[model samples]
Target: MKSKGPPGGGLVYSTESGRMCPGCRQPVAACVCARQPARPAGDGVARVSRTTAGRGGKVVTLVRGLPLDDAALAALGKQLRTACGSGGTVRDGSIEIQGDHLERVMAWLQAQGHAVRRVGG
Candidate 1:
């Protein structure tokens, strides 16, 4: 499918401004895109669950339904990993901690005043 271009179909880069924002055609550093609020990915409640479906019987605790932006999500994921003393990564708006820490995660999130729910067996 043919995609629409930016307003006026302006240049995406300039020697004077470096890279431009495709949405605004302004220099990335001054683009209004950065100031816009991200659309929430889920309900306000955060869900904690454990799954061993992908790995070879390895367990990972998945936290989903957070309404935070990438930066805040990364920070929250880091704190959760540290509190659980495990390593993990945040991807696709979900936090994947490297072990089964559902209880720990739920408790910690509750302590942090987040509305948390458990999912899966």
Candidate 2:
């Protein structure tokens, strides 16, 4: 089939942007179909847990099922990290704070009016 042009340029690569989006023929940053993950309406509860499964012997506190949009979730993650005096990242709609600050996180979430449920011991 003859592919459309201009908006649907379908260029595999772009000189100006280095890499262009196939769907919108624009730079990835400006593309209409931004590669954001499908937003999940989580299972109706904010869950907190601690795990040391993958990080050698270091512990990390994980918070999942937050019902915030990307921007808000990132901002909330920053706030939580700051509050916990630790470092963290927001990934796949969840926050991972470095260290086992589960109690502190639950308190902070409750202060922020979220119904937090502790998942693991």
Candidate achieving the largest lDDT = 1
Query: Who wins the TM-score comparison?
Result: 2
lDDT of 2 at 99: 96
Worst 10 residues of 2 by lDDT: 3-12
Q: Clashing residue pairs, candidate 2?
A: none
Task: List model 1 lDDT by residue over 2-116, tens digit each.
Answer: 5576665778789998989987778999999779565567888999999988789999999999999899999999999999999999988899999989999999999999999
Q: Each model's C-alpha lDDT? A: 0.91, 0.88
Q: Could you report the Cα RMSD, in angstroms, for every candidate shown?
A: 6.9, 7.2
Per-residue accuracy of model 2 over 1-121 as CA lDDT, tens digit each: 7756645455767677777777766787788887665878787578999999988999999999988888999999999999999998998889999998999999999999999999977
Runs in model 2 deviating more than 4 A are: 1-37
| Error of model 1, residue 107, in angstroms | 0.3
